[model samples]
Target chain A: MNIDAFAFDFQELNKEIKSSGQEELNIDNCMGQRYIGCGLSRGSLRIRGVPGNALGAYLNGADITVHGNAQDSVGDTMNEGKISIHGSCGDTPGYAMRGGKIFIRGNAGYRAGIHMKSYRDKCPVMVIGGSAGSFLGEYQAGGRIIVLGLGSDQPCPVGYFCGTGMHGGKIFLRCGQLPASLPDQVNAKLADDVDLQEIEEDIRQFCAEFDLDRETILDHPFHVLTPNTKNPYRQLYVHC
Target chain B: MQIDYFYPEYEVVRNKEKCTRCGLCVSQCSNHVHSYSEEHRRMITDDAKCVNCHRCVCVCPVGALKITGSNHQFKHNANWSRRTIMEIYSQAETGGVLLSSMGNPKDMPVYWDKILINASQVTNPSIDPLREPMETKVFLGSKPASIERDENGRIRNNLPPHIALDVPILFSAMSYGSISLNAHASLVHAAVDLGTCYNSGEGGLHDDFYRYSANTIIQVASGRFGVHKEYLEAGAAIEIKMGQGAKPGIGGHLPGNKIVGEISKTRMIPEGSDAISPAPHHDIYSIEDLRQLVYSLKEATGYKKPIIVKVAAVHNIASIASGIARSGADIIALDGFRGGTGAAPTRIRDNVGIPIELALASVDERLRQEGIRGNVSLIAGGSIRNSADVVKALALGADAVYIATGALVALGCHLCRGCHSGTCNWGIATQDPALVSRLDPEEGRRRLVNLVSAWTHEIKEMMGGMGINSIEALTGNRLMLRGVGLNAKELEVLGIMHAGE
Candidate 1:
């Protein structure tokens, strides 16, 4: 079923999509409609044009592909599913998301993948083709975030304050050098064969989705960032 | 070393004549305060190790054990008191922020005690609750202005969702990581039995408690821990936790040690990883951002559940609440500075935020002045001590009240203020398996039910005395309340008249 989404607001468009009784939907002319495919399961959506903030919030088990640029919080707290953005997206692309995969072909704004987590057999993954903004993976508890830095000229693909307050999970950046402003609580090292091998499939998947060569994306020296497990804030409080 | 060493605050006084030396206190105290010496043939008590939780006192078979405040005093000075000096010494020694549990134990005024309720005289007849129908039930949600009608002259049902409560009390948010799972079980069971609701704090709901979804209010905080699509759909309502009362501006940090076992699974984070809730939701910078979250939740839940926005009672709370009331929220839950927490910084808990009484009064007045009071229901919390406090809150404009410290008291908490230590003598706070096993969920549930039931009876009695048959009638009825010792400015802020006026 194809939805014009031209005459309807977010509420009406969502209502029509929910009651459309179709397994697959193609939303066209979607200009800044927020919360598209929110909390939806058991359906596939293809959206054209720009969607507003919280594009696929709390989305459970639905496949959403945005043909154009998306706004902030693209997959806020989404549980299970896959979201693919063909163009650049705004901040917090996968904020607090668990058990899903979000693929962005172009650059992402600040705080991308902040607080992304995972559970047993439900690891969340985000693959950004281009560079990412500052505070990437801030306070991330679980999951994997990969920044390919496909066309960036900077030595590092991520901005300042990368992995600030990160307690769990790993971030793979295809870069020559690590960010200088990395916090002491975070440990960054050059990725070895084992580390590169683990996320190779994810990089390949991102390359395949964006019609790029996997070998070219993996040619650069990669760096992995993980939180120091010594419990950074342990001695910060005393009983009163 | 002598300058740094301080005397214990409490001393255990054991009666030598009545003591049977059963060693019950030695086995009962989790803080290792009591130890029996084989050579001495008696139990030795360590006052410094004691938190004064009353566990040893209650468990002793003989009526021989009692704890008393030690007379060890510094040169009494108005400016530098013993507690004040001790806190300074503690911080100087450890160079760490002082952390405290439960509510503020400060010397601030509690306005609930100053406000008095009115009774009926010969002009108005007091209805007996037993003989007459006195309704304590309340429905919390946005109230529609007028009924819609169809073209055929029939009433159209366009009312929004509401949470029906048998009483005007709810079990406030206490996350699984903060409290034991059994504590959550007890609160949820009591809520189900009482026909009310329990809030699942920032920590996600456990899988076992999904059966109680009919009485659950799942919360979404800055961290979004354990929040998923199923969790949202499982709740009777959803609450967006903007801020907590104890530490108004600061965020919550459940130490890495407490994030173990079910907490790790429920929160969906790795074991031994810190569960940090940032102070602000990154996506929400303004009321428009709040509206986005509120609608996102509504869109996720299909607009079937009422969305509650819980905020701390801080300065500029009236305007903040006005903004929230217009942010498409169905309920506004205001938690005052005196509200309890599993753990919070001592300075932040004691000094931050304002009293719920004044905040509620001003927010209620502001909303009513703007003619948007019906847009959202108000639930006030922070130290609702007794039934009188509940009645006073309603008269001050709260649709209902939330009880956490009072509820934990019913669950056998002795207010030791040691929750941050993760060794609660009672099973209410700690996650230790042995300590957690001490509290039986059934027993806790019964005590909570008894507390709410007793409060409900007293509320009916108070409502009957006021000649108000329902809680709705008493809500915002400030004429029924009079200030006693409050000054003119305090009385004006409370929107109540002085006594005899």
Candidate 2:
């Protein structure tokens, strides 16, 4: 089923997409249409042109492939699904994600992978191909965030205040130089062999999805950040 | 052991002449406030442990027990009060943030009491509610700005998904860990029976209560605890909990002791780990960011259910509501400062957030002025005690009101203000199995149903008295309301005129 996105309300488009019998939707000319494939499960979506904010939000088990750029809040609070963006995505990608994979072929904006969590077998994985903006993975409780500086011009791959309030989970930045002001609550060091193995399959899939050299991306030194203590707010409050 | 330094705030008097000594209070009190001393052959009261919940007073075989404010006052000074001094002592004793339960009980101005309702006297005849068909049923959702019709000249319903209710009342969010499983069951059953809805707070939906999904509204707070695809699908709607009235700008903290077997499974955390909901949704830093989240939930639910953005009533609420209305939210639920909480820092609960009455009025006026009132339904709450408050809230512009403290009160909550302690003598706010069993859900369900139904009847009658047969006719009809003791600013802010003017 193909829906031409022209002069149609986002709500109307969504309603039609949901009520339609077709499991595969090809939305063309999606000029900044917001909330495409939201909360949808058991579907395959191919979106052309720029999709607006909250693309595939709360998306449950839907596989969305955006051929062009996406605006802010891509995959916000998405539970289980796969969002593959071939172009650069805007801010807050894969935020509060519980289980899913968000593969951005290009750079991501600020606060990507913030508050993403994981349960028993469900670990949400976000792979940003290029450099990410500031406050990356802020207050992340669970899940995995991988920022591979495959192609970026900045002196550092990530901007200021990366993983500021991160408590649980791990943030892997494949960069040589690190930010000067990482919060003292977290530990940032060279990725161990165990950490590399854990993200090996995700890196492989991200590379295959974007047609990148997997070995080259992985050959770079990676830095993994995890909360130093279980109590992140130990020094935050004065007890009284 | 901690030294005993302060006197109790309440004194329990038991009339020995009428005492049968049935030992009900001794067993029923979860705080162990009463015990039958063998040496005295009489029940001795422990005032220090008592929260004045009135469990003993309610359960006493005879009318033999009464609790009153203690006369153990310190030397009075105009600048220093007893409570302030004691609070300082307690904080000094245990260098921890003082936690309290329930709403603010300070002597703040209650705007609800200042407003008055007008009844038809002459020109408009009052309708008989009992004899006539009175429509109290309300549907909460975004209404289309203009009606759309099919090409065949047929009316097309283009409105979004709505939460339909027999009356304009909803049970506000109270987490399972904060309250009890039996309490949740009671609320769920009562909501189902009354054709209303109750919230699951920040706690994940308990597996057993999944059967009552139709009457449930699963809330997504900052914690995202127990938030999964199944949990999102299990409710009629999803509420984005940005803030609560009791503790605005603060995250929720479910103490480790409250995280038991079922709670652990529900929240998807360990058995004894503290569950904390962060202060803000890191994704939503701005109101436009709020729009992103609102759409996210809508997308997640497949646009099948309404998405409510619940916020604490703040100083600049009207503008906040205007932004939320534009954010594609189906409903905006406002909670005032007096709203109940499972637990909150005492200082924050009392001092933070604004009154619901003012927030409701200003937000409604702003939305209507912006011609966006139809875009979102409004629900106001905090301390709506009766049907009149419901009527005033509607007349002031709320589509409906969320009731929590009032609902809990109907279930035998005596406002003991010890909910954070988690040893609720009435079994209304505790997770203890023994204490929880005291509150039979069957009986609780009946009581809640009765309370809501009776309030519905009162609201209908109030509407009829105002010469309005349908609730829609009374909604945002400021002519049906008038200010009594309110000043110019108060009246102007409320958009209502003084009586006889």
Candidate 3:
């Protein structure tokens, strides 16, 4: 089913999509409509034009593809879904996401993948093809965040304070050197073959999704970042 | 190599004449304050190890043990009290933030004690609660501004989703990670029995507790732990924890060591990973951003459940509450500075937010003046100690009251304020297997039920005394309350008159 969402507000468009009982939907001319597939468990939605903040928040198991740029909080706290953005996205693209995958073909704004955690058998993944803004993966408890930086010349792809307060998870950055502003709480090392194997399938998937050559994307030396200490606050307090 | 400047604050006294060498005290204390001395043929006590939990004293087979404050005191200096001197010494030694558990124990004014309730005389007939049908049931949510009728002239069913409470008392938020599963079960069972609700604070709900979802209010905080589609849909209501009163403006850091096994699974994080809840929601930069979250949750739930926004009772709370009300929240829960916590920095817990009484009064007045009081129901919490405090909160404009410390007290908490150590002898705040097993869920549930039931009965009696047949009638009825020994400025902020006037 194709929906011309030019004249419809977010609530009306969402209501029509939910109540239509269709398994597949194509939302055209979508102009900054927030929460496009909010909490939708099933079905596939293809959105054209710009979508607003929190596009697929709490999405259970649906598939959402945004043709144009998406706003902040693209997949806020989303679980069990796949969101693909063709263009650049705003801040906090995958904030606190527990599961599912978010593939951004273009650069992402600040705080992408912040607090993204993983439970048993459910690991969330986010792949940023271009540079990411500051505080990337801040306080990230689990999951994988890969920044390819497909066409950048900087020392690192992520901005300052990357992985600050990070306690879990690994951030794979395709860079020659780690960010200078990286906090002491996180440790960075050159990616080994064993370390690269963990994210090989995810990188291959990202390459296929964005129609890029896998060999070219994997040509550069990568730096994998992991939290040095799981208990960052163990020594910060004394019992009164 | 270290000189201990601070002495033990408490002394453990054991009576030799009455004592039998049963070794009950040795096993009862989790702090290892008592041990058998084989050489001396008696039990030895470590006063420094004692947290004053009273577990050993209560469980001793013979009446032989008592704990008392040590007579050791600092020099006669008014400013440098004993606690102050010891605290400085301790900080100098460890160089760590002083962390405390439970509510503030500072000498602060509790307005509930200074407020007096009204009774009817010959002017108005006081009804007997036992003989009359006193209505205590309250529906919490937004009420319609005007009545609507269908085409057939019948009243339209335009009421939105709301929660019904048999009494105006609710068990406040205490997460599974910060407390034992048995403690959570007790609150859940008691809430179901009382037709009220218990909140699942920040921590994700355990699978075993899903059966009591009808009486649960699941919370979503900064960390968004264990918060997923299923968890969001499993509760009667959703609460967005903006701030905790005990440590307002600061986020909670449940150390990684405590996040093990069930807690790790429940919170959906790796075992031994720090569960850090950031102070502010990165997505919520303004009221507009808050609205987005509220509506997003609403859309996710299909608008079936109410959304509660819980914030600490801080300065400018009235304005903050107004913003929340306009943000499409169905309820606003205000937790005051004196609210309980599993652990908080001693400085922050002692001197952070305002008292619940004053916060409630100002917020209620602000909402009413703006004609938006019906937009959201107010739940006042902090130090609601007794039935009288509940009554006083209602009179000051709280739709209901949330009780946490009081409920834990009912479940055998000795108020030792040692929850941060993760060695609660009462089993209310620890995740240790043995300590958790100490609290039987059935007994805890019964005690909670008894406490709420007794409080409900007393609330009805107070309403009857005020010539009010229903609790709703007593809400925001400041005439039912009078200030006693409160200064003029204090009464003005409380929005109450003097006792004589």
Candidate 4:
């Protein structure tokens, strides 16, 4: 099913898409059509223009791709399937996603993977080719977030408070120096062979998806930020 | 050696003569407070470890055990109370924020006790529930101000989905992880049998319980745990939990130990990792943002389920509820300060938020003043004890009342307020295998059914005595209620005339 979403209402477009009985949907000129592919259990969506906030929210097992930039909350609480963005996305992208992978070619806004949790094999992965804003992976219980500094030469690839309240999961940032003065709960160290090996396949997949040299991306020093302890708060608050 | 800062609040007492030295208490005490002594061939108990859960006492074969308040005394002052002194000492010792469980146990003025219900007299004779047609049925959702007909003058059924309740009572939000799966199953079965609903708190709904989806109210809090397509679509209604009454401005942290097994799989978080729901939805900083979330859920569910916006009863509760009425929500749930929690900072639990009675009266009044009272149904929670409370809440302008602590009690919770430890012996609040197994869902469901059924009967009797046949007629009927000892301000806030008027 092909939809020209230039002047069509978002609700109407979604209604038509759901009733069209097609697994593959192509939407053109999709400017700020919010909640695209929302709660879609099946089907693959291809959007030509920028989608709005909460794109693919609670997407159970669908695949979505945007030729242009996407808005905030790209895949909020989405369970399964994949979302690939061609350009930059706004804040809280992939927030609290439990399953599937989100690949972005350009930068992402604040709270890229806040509260992202992973369980068993249903791990969620978010890879950003460019820089990211602050509060990256904040309160991240699980899942993997890899930010590759493919663009500008910033000292640190991400902004401040990176991986704050991170209990589980690993964050890979391509940078020379660590972000300054991390919280007492987290530790930032240069990636060793073992750390690099863990995310090697994901990094390769990211590079392969965005057309980048794997060897060149691997040669640069990468910094890993991890929580000092997963559950540091055990009966910390004791009332008399 | 670690220094003991405070003494045991209660000491377990055992009758040596009655104790048979069978070691049953040793096996029953999950806190490991009891140990069998080889030297004396008797049970040695630790007073400090006793949470007074009564697990041992309840399981004792010889009916010889009881917990007594310790006689330990301190050089106390009126202003500097014992608890205050210990609190200061504990803070000085560890510098930690105080954590506690359950609802506030402080002796604040209980407004429900202050307000009196009036019975019909000779002028209007009371109707007997046994003989007369009494109704406890309540439909919860937004009702149009008035019915509008179509072009042909035929009545149109354009109302949104509403929860049909045989009683005004519902089992409130106690998340799957916070309580055991068996407990959830019990609530599910009970709600189904009682023609009411139970909430899936913030924890995501387990796949096994989807059969009871019609009786569930899946919650979408700041954490959005276990939330997905099927979860949102499963429930009869969806509740957006903005704030809890116990800890108004606080988030939640389900510790790593409890986040194992099915809980981890259900919540989709790693095993043995802290699940922290932030204090506020970062995206929702204003009312417009709140409206967007409400509509987002509505769109997600295809508008098949009613959206309930739950907010804590605070100082500005009237204005907050007023704004919520216009937020496209079908129902507004007001949780007072006495609401329960698995774990909360003690200060907030004891000090934050107002009582539900005041909040409900004011919110109902405010929505009515704004002429949007029909836009949403009002539900009040926060320590609704019995049938009388439910009736009073309805008369005070609430369409229904939610009960959590009562439901837990029906499932064998002693309200030890140690739910945060995840070692509930009666099995209502714990995820531990043994403790959870102790609570048979079949038996738990029976007790729960009995509790709500009894409440329903009592509610009918109360309504019958008021000469009101149906709950819809009794709703917001403040004339049937009178203030007992309340002053001018309290009477005005409650919108009830003083008794003898």
> By DockQ, highest first, what's the ranking?
3, 1, 4, 2
Q: What is the TM-score of each candidate against the true structure?
A: 0.98, 0.90, 0.98, 0.95
Candidate 1 - CAPRI tier?
medium
Worst-scoring 10-residue span by lDDT in model 4 chain B: B1-10
Q: Who is ahead in DockQ, 2 or 3?
A: 3
Q: What residue runs in model 1 are displaced by over 4 Å at the alpha carbon?
A: none
lDDT of each: 0.92, 0.87, 0.92, 0.88
State the displacement of the C-alpha of residue B80, model 2, in Å, after optimal TM-score superposition.
Answer: 2.1
C-alpha lDDT (0 to 100) for residue B32 of candidate 3: 93
> Among these predicted structures, which one has the highest DockQ?
3
| Candidate with more favorable, higher DockQ: 1 or 3 | 3
Question: Tens digits of per-residue lDDT for model 3 on B192-237?
Answer: 9999999999999999888888899999999999898889999989
Give each prediction's DockQ, rounded to 2 decimals. 0.73, 0.30, 0.80, 0.60
User: What does each candidate score in C-alpha RMSD?
Assistant: 1.3, 3.3, 1.4, 2.3
TM-score of chain A of 3: 0.98
Over A166-191, each residue of candidate 4 has an lDDT whose tens digit, in order, gives 88788888888887757767778899
| TM-score preference between candidates 1 and 4, better one | 1
Give a tens-digit lDDT track for model 2, residues B368-429: 99999999999999999999999999999999999999999999999988887778987778
